[model samples]
Target chain A: MITIELNGQQQPLPTGSTVSDLLSTIGSDGKSVAVLVNQQIIRPENRPTLMLQEGDQVELLIFAGGG
Target chain B: MDLLQLGSHSFSSRLILGTGKFSNAAVMLQAVRASGAQLVTVALRRFNREQAEDDLFGPLSTIEGVTLMPNTSGASTAAEAVRAAHISRELSGSAFIKVEIHPNPQHLMPDPIETFEAARILAKEGFLVMPYITADPVLAKRLEEVGCAAVMPLGSAIGSGQGLANAAMIELIIRESSIPVIVDAGLRSPSEAAHAMEMGCGAVLVNSAVAVAGNPPEMAEAFAEAVAAGRKAFRAGLMQKSGSAIATSPLTAFLGATL
Candidate 1:
């Protein structure tokens, strides 16, 4: 198991857990978010293939109304 | 009326709405529908699941003929703005992005160098870059050369409600820009929006003036009518202003004498 920061909260995930797994674990479709792993944005197509490691910081950003 | 063209896209409405400062998402949607704005701007931020599950996009999607124009509001540098643009594209599924790089939180004045840099990169990446910039004629032309879809120049400081403190500079930008010139920020009323159109701006993006008004929906409607009226006035051609007051009636007709 490796610890990762998910949306500012530290959580432990099994070794070799990809972004897709993270989304599934959180009950999200990954459709409404822009995920960044270690400060690099992970495209939706690559989310399933990109694996998270120990101490990896992940950020999921959502779109809000703006001016 | 001719269509308002920005890059390859054309829109009938010359007023672009900003979704910030509304009382709520529901109220925002109502005002947007009332405004008749085809393109609306939204910000990209960390997805907060705790906030009411009613995401802004879900409600916004119900309004037909509306396109999402996400803005990089919090980005302070060109790289950050570029990253935000990519994120916005992936999230919003729209090619239109508003590049707003304001490092200074006090005034929220967009950084010109950063804006130009971001516009250049985003334009090459096949994104329609609309950069918010100061009312500088030269920078407006530069952004055009960089392949920006449009130039959004400030009428005054952001959210100031001062109403075109830089009207002459904005006019100069409008005159020099080959692409669309959208006057963004610092417009407080429909009359100010009309004034921007009369100065030959392609469109005006207003937020606070309507969102913070006594009645957001009604204010939106007022702005819509004002933009249409201003565009019509521009198309009709405005009379030249002169130092001497020329009588509407022929000077000789009223006096029964020739000047």
Candidate 2:
């Protein structure tokens, strides 16, 4: 298992978990969410190819109400 | 048609709606529809499974003619805002980004320096940057010079509903700015929106005024009408004010005994 930071919180994932796998584990279908790894956007097509390693900084953002 | 032109995009409604402070998504959507706002503002928040309903992109997308203008509200610095803009562009596929960098939440006053930096960079990156700033004419002009799509000066503090406390400065901005001057905050009623438009603002953004009203949808409709009326009134030309009253009828001898 490898530990990665998800939205500022530590989360444990299996070894070599891809971005898609992480989203699936979190019960998100990867819709309407922006995934960033190390401050770089991981596009939808690349989510399956991008592998998560230990200490990877991951952030998933969605649009919320604002003025 | 008299469209509010921002960058290369045109919008029929001058009343830009904010998606915050609503009781729920349903009512928010109702207000969005009733407001007829083609451009709406939203923020980037961390996705939590427990609060999946907080995500507004899907629901707002369903509303036709609604374009997302994601704001960099949570960012305290230029770097953070720039990063958020990039991510938001990736998500929304829209070039519009509202550069709102208020470091201290107490007053919610945008940091002019950071906002200008973010707007300059974002505009150069080919994004239509609409910067929310204080009602400072100098700053507004500077942002315009940096290629911003529009300058959104606060009517007062964010969410305060003070109703154009900074009207004087805002008017100065409108007079000097070549780009759209949008009053983006602190509006309480439809009249205030109309007043802003009458004062020559290109657009007005409202959130708390509609979201907290007794009937949000009705209030939204009222604001939309007021904005249109004010814009029309402005286009038709407003009469100048005078210190003394001027007689409408010929003060001629019609009422007098002598011709």
Identify the runs in model 2 with alpha carbons over 4 angstroms from their true place.
Answer: B250-259
* Candidate 1 chain B: 10-residue stretch with minimal lDDT: B250-259
List model 1 lDDT by residue over B1-259, tens digit each.
Answer: 5889988899999999999989888889999999999999999877766773545777887899999999999999999999899988988889999999999999999999999999999999999999999999999999999899999999999899999999998888877878989999999999999999988999999999999999999999999999999999999999888999777765556555544
What is the TM-score of each predicted model, taking all chains together? Answer: 0.93, 0.97
Candidate 1 to truth, TM = 0.93
- The TM-score of predicted model 2 comes to 0.97
The CAPRI-style docking tier of model 2 reads high
TM-score for chain B in model 2: 0.97
- The lDDT of model 1 is 0.91
Candidate 2 displacement at residue B41 in angstroms: 0.6
